[model samples]
Target chain A: MAAPPGPESIALLERFVAALKAQGVVTEEEIAEQIARTDRASPEIGARMVARAWTDPAYRELLLRDGSAAAEQMGVSMAGAPPLGVLEDTDTLHHLVVCTLCSCYPRMVLGYPPHWYKSAAYRARAVRDPRGVLAEWGTVLPDGMELRVVDSTADYRWMVLPQRPAGTEGWDETRLASLVTRDALVGVTLPMVAERAAA
Target chain B: MQDDAPPPATHDLGGAPRFRCTPVEPDDAAPPDAFGKRVDALRQLLARKGLMSVDELRRGVEAIPEAEYHALGYYERWLRSISGIMVEKGVVPAEALKP
Candidate 1:
């Protein structure tokens, strides 16, 4: 009898690709072009809600009360998608996001989480040492910051909009929006200061 | 290509060991032609969008000669591991890297 196919054989390649597609990452475009037959994402809607939450105390309270409804109120569609939970980071407890199961996330709000956050190294490490995971992402916690790692399984999606840094007391929404790194918003890393060296 | 890679023995995921599927350097266990294409595919998926670590992957990819680099058998496993590491580092969309 023939040996099972080698890892690089064409048959193996097809199997891997098919397996990956059967998973969700390959489904976004296909979900639109062939399967779902529509284009609907809630990134802008989520972003706006995050911004509003940062601005108004009442709105933030509302968001904490009902994440899905709050997201919808911002004009983001969440039809046929999993539930979303927004995590808020404070001086005491900082949150990091990881998908131990298949990479399930709130794609509607955040668009796409960065690729690195999905590695096996990340999966094992994040659960094993949450603080270490943040360090790799270059997050130097404040003088007294606590770390919390949240698991984003295939069933439920989540997002994070970290607390605005201290210096930008009166910055407008646009400026604040610029501070939200894709990873930070998703809770993998902390919001960073993208300093421009003076000429 | 990492300075600290899991030892040169076959890759052990859980208790099941995945022997060297890609050809290793001549001195290693993989035959001269074992893992050429499998490495290629892993490199392609990792290199897709400046996501995975170039230095590390380049080291692994460059270690094997092109001729023997194309025969790895566990394609799915390679993506799983590659994407796992990528996801670990925040380089893939969670869903994209999910197993």
Candidate 2:
């Protein structure tokens, strides 16, 4: 938006990339493919993991125990990446993730972090007033639910395993996965029964 | 800004009070801006080349002056860190990056 960087600066960056290529540190092909891989890293992977966890108890156990390994088992490659942690949102406890320091995220699984996720307001308020922040994101949990604010402070990135919506008892994985939005996985909102029915 | 509060660090923003309702819209479909992509690619190349470690990049980003830290956007910080680290490490002379 608003033309991020001017042409001169961009030309300088192009020259920088050329220098790197010339040094044999990286190639244009590798950079292109990495960009493509960034695009491929989407919430769909998290959604599929959630859907599988909802349908399979053993998989849910595995997901809760070792998130990175479970993700790999489901064909999501996080090899050599920092450990991924999945927090289970239950009847009494809800998990909300914010990197108050930096915009650390599970980008390997969830594609790009949302703009607000990296905002100063979010980083500051999510820890101070999580309920207020969640309400701003259109999520208002029931009164007295223990809100657990998890910071991505260290090497671990977190994603919330939101509770499965009611009234989707017989739904298949595809149908269930359709209801799992990125925001839901982030614990800012819940998967709506209406969304599941629409699928 | 609390007068009696601890000195502000660049990254310790949790629970610091400045109440403002900043609503965010979903931009999942919008493509990344050109400079953002280039900066990200440059970071990868820099890391791969052993010129900069992810830890070093994080440290550089965290070390950005406090005023600029609040002023810069997400990728802008990465760009600044990449530029700053390249200069600090002498991988590229500062003049080479001058526009």
Candidate 3:
């Protein structure tokens, strides 16, 4: 476990907040609102998009061509966030995303990044040995398949549009969305039909 | 082809060989704890005030000393970067950050 912030560090942060408030630079209400807004985001939003894409070819095209607009079409507000890019996983190729410099996630759709995504171990290994990293996550790709690692830099954030799993044909968007986990959207693992039985 | 590229910063670990052997922990999907949410809220508030941008925040994080950079946790680094940028941008005086 990481060490708790020392009392001195807490004091420093308290002082800084007090200073900002004195200057009218920020308000407590604004900070509370921001936290509430961030809390509203979750993987379920992304799953809704993925399930729609899987069932509707036209929506899938729109998602690939313009991610932000597609997200807006689903009533998600992308007013201040960076452009969202969707990486389509295919039969012969898979894509994994990492930000080697820092964690630049698609927070508007997928909520806050998972703890492991921000770790130095993940940031370094995801780019160098994506296949190995995926394997450690129990996501071994078939031999001869190509693995592409995309860097989610400061300008653009990325999420994977994992291919629709088999045995899910004719499933409605809601049911299909149930299978798309947060890990699948990040490309760390594929959406599995087996989860339905387990759940 | 030019071969004189400068060495990557300590934070730039895209394919550095040293991390190849490090083990990655399993995913923990829990939301950010209370302290982390507070730090994140602070950052969002700063950005809304136009006092800082995400790029500036990233720069501040990347500028941390290598040893300290590795030692700090995720949101700790974020809080450090946010405070540093606030001082650097004159949004907060350096003395205000002195504990």
Candidate 4:
């Protein structure tokens, strides 16, 4: 566990909260609700959306067209977040999303970003050498496949629509979602095909 | 306010070859602690109140020294930016933050 905040920090926090109350910036209930909203965010929401998109072309189109609305259809809330941009990956092209400045991300969908996603190495190298960065994450693309790096700036957040892996033809959405990891949605990895031999 | 280093553009990190390429593995998901929760709450409240824009917060966070930036955790950076902006706007006195 991380160390507790120092006495000075606690005092500062008290003063900060008091100032907010005094200035009518927010009510206690409102702050609680905001925190609760963040609490409700989870990566499963993204996994489910990706699974459904793989099953239904219409939903895939909708997801690509309006990510927030598509998320709302599945009972996910994108409140207080910038517009979501779902990058579609095709057989010939790949997409990787990064926020080169700081870790601006689609928190509403993917919950908190992984620690490495916020690392300076990722922020700098992702833009400098996307293919190499993805390779470091164990993702390699075939030759001649175009890799597009989309920087999610202050005004927008992005996620990758990873291409459905081959050989998962007759699987249910739940089973397919099991293969979608958070890294896949971030464009670092692709969904793996379930091994029948393990079963 | 000008120095030898390039002008302050936080989001202009694309194609900058100065940084080393060492991908750190992500840690397991941990629930927010008291400090992180408070910082997140304060950020939402400040934004809702129109006292601090996201752009302003980004500027403040990016203005942090690179070494400290790398040393601080994700939400820790938010707290640093919050503290800096609050003091700069005179919402909270700097003396109150003195350790």
Number of the top candidate by TM-score?
3
DockQ of 4: 0.45
Expressed as tens digits, the lDDT of each residue in A40-104 for candidate 2 is 88988899999999999999999999999989997888864679999999899999888988777
Give the DockQ-based CAPRI class for model 1. incorrect
Two-chain complex of model 1, DockQ on C-alpha atoms against the true structure: 0.04
| Model 2 regions lying over 4 Å from their true place | A1-3, A6-12, A196-199, B1-5, B19-31
Ranked by TM-score, the better of candidates 1 and 4 is: 4
lDDT of 1 by residue, A66-140 (tens): 788888877776765578888888778888777653345676676533334433355556666656556655667
TM-score of chain B of each: 0.32, 0.76, 0.88, 0.73
What is the C-alpha local distance difference test score of candidate 2?
0.78
Tens-digit lDDT string for candidate 4 (A1-199): 3345555556666776766667666678887887887778877889999999999999999999999999989987677679998999999998888888777788888987766776667788887788878877677899999989888878999999898889889989998888888888889887877543264
User: What is the DockQ of the complex in model 2?
Assistant: 0.47
lDDT of 3 at A140: 84
Q: In model 3, state the lDDT of residue A25.
A: 89
List, residue by residue over B15-95, the lDDT tens digit for candidate 4.
666665565454445456767777887897788777798898888888888776656666667777887898899876676
Ranking of predictions according to TM-score: 3, 2, 4, 1
Best by lDDT: 3
Clashes in predicted model 1:
41
